[model samples]
Target: MTSCSPTLEPPSPSRIPAHHVPIIPPPPLPPGPQDLAFSPPLGSLQAPIPPPPPLPPSPPAMGTAPPHVFGLEKSQLLKEALEKAGPVPKGREDVKRLLKLRKDRFRSDLCWILFCADLPSLIQEGPQCGLVALWMAGTLLSPPSGIPLERLVQVATERGYTAQGEMFSVADMGRLAQETLDCQTELLCGGLGGPNRDLVLQHLVTGHPLLIPYDEDFNHEPCQRKGHKAHWAVSAGVLLGVQSVPSLGYTEDPELPGLFHPVPGIPCQPPLLPEEGSPGAVYLLSKQGKSWHYQLWDYNQVRDSNLQLTDFSPSRATDGRAYVVPAGGVQAGLCGQALLLRPRVSSH
Candidate 1:
């Protein structure tokens, strides 16, 4: 052991180990990183941007309030849309976009405030749904030139369009529209058990509302056997080609703007849908007995309602001319019958 300690001396330079260097870490990044910037990592939690403030309590449900609730005079584009068949504005931004670009894409719910009368007053005395529908259609097409509902009902009675205050025959209604409203009427036969999809889209986009007949009772669930009571209504707006993911028998029909709540007596369903390429929802200005308002029905609801009216006959019309009793008169129901009404163009 003594001998080994004595021999411990400075050996060769290669044998000696290298000197250790003290390592120092880099300085921290600046508070804001002035020179370099980076966005937050993907899928990171971020402060949410707030949503829009809610609208005023739904504007008293369509038919509940006075005529001023429709607010037609507030927007000139709305006036032009209903009166001149001008391009409809989808939303607030769409209004500006249409005004500036003048290019339209039909991808939203179209609405026209064509009917703003007191419903209770109009249909209180009798079964005048057909006349009310015609009145709405005439007003939509003719603007300030449309005749009064009373006058229209009187004329329909005198002309035999209605019997015992009810209108049942689709053909007779078409004739009535032509003669009374001075409308160029085109009757579309739903040969395929529903409304003609092409015809519905074509007329609706051109500001021509359809006078359609459907069983009012069939709209709600718990199907009843009240033998179809054909109720007439006017389609004020139509949402066609609703964008939906073509999956296994499902749809995602976008809702119309505004807080549309369900009324007590109206039929409220989970937005009944049709096939992908079929007719979409229809917003009908309908009057059923005491309840008069806008009803939302999918294409199938309208079709089913139309189909249910197969056994419906006029309440009082005995003559063949008063009902759907033509030469080969067998198909009696107003199955998918729609009247395309256009104002008679004056040839000055």
Candidate 2:
């Protein structure tokens, strides 16, 4: 068998076609005298191609809806919640007007210091919902000293207001609010369920937040099933019956004007039923880690939650003075309990 060499000789010139013959080009160099002229081999160096000019930065999308907090869009939830709620009621319109006025005055008015977005979400590390709520209220109502939650816990523990993971008395909470917040506390009896519903509305409408101690479980006893404790939340404001709350957790939809989707949740209350009428939902802001949970609850939901306190027997009741009419005797423990916090110095 004949073996072929790996390196073969070039093709014979006579056998190659004339057009196929290789052409050796002259060196690429400028004309010059023989002694001074020099040129590198043709393929040695190359001129680097400059990258195409970077595309102009894209303009930000106008009217972009905020990212959704949940799978559903804000408009979908709002439509579903209000389909039967009828047209926006007059009371709701009035509330909207007042809230708008407050929004307009937010920068100039100290009374409107706490907007729905302004509520800091301080989570409870242990059975210290009350203390956390107190901290939120204290820090917001008074000048900001940047007091941490640990400090509030230490304060409450020293005062004997908290022990064994239980806030045993509502009266103690009132006193604690007065002492820690340096603000007068008015315990109100009505909570959208009783006769003082209008008053509670007034408190919230005027930008006063309520520290409500409720079952937190609503009718669902998730805590009892898990052997946990009760809860407290700050009621920031009541939502307009027909308006979209974008701040708490909504963004305007770019595709459709005046439409929104849930950024996780709405800033204010969830949508309400037609029968519930206008000014239907309340914004309940609670801590969940670093951020907060925004819930829009129907008036009855908040009412029933607050009223559940009536069944809670307080460990002690040193202060029984409630501003509104008491359904039970004044001595009744934790009945229709709510703390309306006003700044110590008038926000004139």
Candidate number of the best lDDT: 1
lDDT of 2 by residue, 1-348 (tens): 111112212222232222221212211222333333245557878564454544453442432211111112323543343333322222222233444554432222111111242344443444566666676666567776545555555455556556532454455667766665667667665344544565666566555767766665543221221112346666655543333342554554453333333444334433322233333333333332212333444556566655645443242233352222124432243446667777777668
CA lDDT, candidate 2, residue 300: 61
Q: Give Cα-based local distance difference scores for all models.
A: 0.46, 0.45
Question: Tens-digit lDDT track for model 1 on 107-197?
Answer: 2443211111222212223456677667657765665646666565555556645554466666767777766666677766653233365
Q: What's the true lDDT of residue 50 in model 2?
A: 50
Give residue 193's error in model 2 in angstroms.
Answer: 2.5
Top candidate on TM-score is: 1
Evaluated at residue 23, the lDDT of candidate 2 is 18
Q: Quote each prediction's TM-score.
A: 0.49, 0.48
Q: Give the TM-score of candidate 1.
A: 0.49
